[model samples]
Target: MRHPHPLPPPGHAEVRIVAATPEAARLIAEALRRRFAATEQRSYPAGGEGGTRLHLTVDTTHTAAAPRPWPATGEASGARRLQADEI
Candidate 1:
């Protein structure tokens, strides 16, 4: 007899990376935009400073299994697994 598969955990992993310059920040945003189906970008001012802040958001639902579907491409699949070294 086959055993039933365990239920996958709830929730998702949120990845955030802050940079010093707009250029560097955009680089990350662009990368995420190319990979994730749902990506968003927002700008905010840095308090007591002149430079602005960039926020990049990526939805990882496509990469989750069970209740969710897997990514169509390998590039998108790779984005799901975040290495400890990358953190």
Candidate 2:
């Protein structure tokens, strides 16, 4: 079963994109909006600087499906395990 909140424990994944212009950033943001369904984008001026920064947030809980292999274990399981050798 999947919880109402389907998220990894808590960490960050960094991504790099080639968005050299405002139009390119808008296009990239639009593409992400379609893919994630629930997404929000905002732009704000930084301090006294003349440049604007874009912020994006995505919520995937509603679309995430239930997990398979209820109790993951053993060799055939999809979960990762720490072997004695590694320990």
Candidate 3:
């Protein structure tokens, strides 16, 4: 039989990465591979406008390495921490 909606198996997660460029989407997928057991990424056009969409299936039960923490506000990484109001 066929189902309109399907779910990933237990301990597995489906991740979709959308970015302005294919390179950006690929980079994000690579980063996720470093943290989890993930399948090779599959990419496709996002919409009428130019954009990239990458899909990956990751095994949450396994960890390749300890997850890195997001950079704190004003850190050298140049990522600004969002305040509650901004969210």
| TM-score for each candidate, following the candidate numbering | 0.44, 0.38, 0.74
lDDT value, residue 70 of candidate 2? 37
Query: What is the per-residue lDDT of model 3 for residues 9-83, given as tens digits with 9 covering 90 to 100?
Result: 999999999999998898789889999999989999999879999999999999988998976554763366768
Off by over 4 Å in 2: 1-18, 45-52, 63-87
Sorted by lDDT, highest first, which candidate order results? 3, 1, 2
lDDT of each: 0.56, 0.51, 0.89
Q: Could you tell me the lDDT of residue 10 within candidate 2?
A: 30
Residue 82, model 2: lDDT of 84
* Best candidate (score: TM-score): 3
| Candidate with better lDDT, 2 vs 3 | 3
Candidate 1 versus the native: TM-score? 0.44
- Which 10-residue span in candidate 1 carries the lowest summed lDDT? 6-15
Q: How well is each residue in 1-87 modelled by candidate 2, as lDDT tens digits?
A: 877844432332222234445565667666555545434567665445454455665545443334345354456534678878886
lDDT string, candidate 1, 1-87, tens digits: 665854333433344556767776677776666656334677676556655577644566553223434455455423467657777
Model 3 stretches astray by more than 4 angstroms: 1-3, 73-87
